[model samples]
Target: MRIKLENGKQNELISLAKRNLTWKELAEKLNVSEYYLRTDLFYEKRLLNSEIFTKLSKIIESDFSKFIKLKLEDNWGQKSGGKKSSGRLKKVLKPEKSEELAELIGIILGD
Candidate 1:
């Protein structure tokens, strides 16, 4: 799941985080990169992992959930939907017999 906060709330979260702790400190505590928090999550306001939001919510002592919009990442387009390969293997084994095997078969029949 991903979390996307409202426009105003985006800046609010950043201010709260800055007041409570250093940006680097917050990133370290949350086990994420500052680049991700600032660039994608805050500035670009892109959908980010809900796990990060949950952890940040705790540190900032705020419930940003009300403004949040959840986006579920799915591979619907990429889903195989049981069509993995070209289906069952070909049963044309006769054509694959070695020349020696064919000769042996003819010898056995006295051909």
Candidate 2:
């Protein structure tokens, strides 16, 4: 099933998932590369396939239907800016003192 998520709902889901599971664990559960989850899904705002959405819903222990907006149509325009931006991922400096700060940085980098 093709679906469009409500605005910022994907990021919200990712935050919820991170609270309960590490990136590695979530990647394994979704059977996708961690890079893809971090880069494509989180950063690029790619739409989720039905299988992955179902797994993510289960992993986050929430009903996903409320977050879904519409069944995506073939000609559905990009909800993000129409053109893809070109750039390299910025280097993140390691956090010195707090692990929580580090994790938050990681989450932002993923976006």
Candidate 3:
């Protein structure tokens, strides 16, 4: 069965997987190569088979159905409108200032 996920669901899955196990560990548990998991599955957004999904759900301790997105026949081939542009000016941070701010945060958090 072909399963489709929301645009960012792949990234979210990777993040959740990482919290419980390292990429290498996860690959070992899934019985796939780490490179395949990182490149083909995570980065390339490959459609996973049900067996893989079941293993993943077991490892992550969450239902995989939550990430599955269902599309009706009418909208099956349609592409979603991509992320909207914020169109707002934002401040850029300098490296030195960013480091200083990080140091201040560290100091405050240590207190």
Candidate 4:
């Protein structure tokens, strides 16, 4: 499915393989509330804000536009009028750099 974004761009939710991240997981990763995340998904037509989106892009090993496109595709492209689920596995923010930064900070702080 595809939907138009605020940028007037069309995006598709090809499959969970595209993002593999859930809305709740993405909220936690962005340090934002799920409500805020869902609001963005529905109203703002985006999953993460610009800054957070950049971080998320790295985390999920995908481009930021992919997230926006996926959200649009997921929420808006449904003609079935039934609930949609991403199957079993969920995708969350998993940036290698974020983990590295955490480890580096722990080492520096002697934690």
Clashes of each: 0, 0, 0, 2
TM-score of 4: 0.34
Q: CA lDDT, every prediction?
A: 0.71, 0.76, 0.70, 0.51
What stretches of model 4 exceed 4 Å from their correct place?
1-19, 45-48, 64-111
What is the C-alpha lDDT profile of model 2 across 1-111, one tens digit per residue?
556788888777776776867788889988999988987787536877778878878877898788788777544555433444436458899657798887887999994
Cα lDDT of model 1 by residue, 6-82, tens digit: 66777677668768577788778778888877676667456656677777688788788888755555443245544
lDDT of 3 by residue, 1-111 (tens): 445667777666666776868889988888888988888788745666556667777767888687788523333334332233345558997666687788898999994
1 against 2, candidate with superior TM-score: 2
Candidate 4's displacement at residue 42, Å, is 4.5
Q: Tens digits of per-residue lDDT for model 4 on 10-55? A: 1232122136667777668667777765565435454433555555
Model 1 CA deviation exceeding 4 Å by range: 74-111
Score residue 88 of candidate 3 by CA lDDT: 56
- The positional error of residue 111 in candidate 4, measured at the CA in angstroms, is 64
Native-referenced Cα lDDT, model 1:
0.71
* Highest TM-score model number: 2
Which number leads on lDDT? 2
Instruction: Quote model 3's TM-score.
Output: 0.54
Off by over 4 Å in 2: 73-111
- Assess every candidate by TM-score: 0.57, 0.59, 0.54, 0.34
Q: Best to worst by lDDT, what's the order?
A: 2, 1, 3, 4
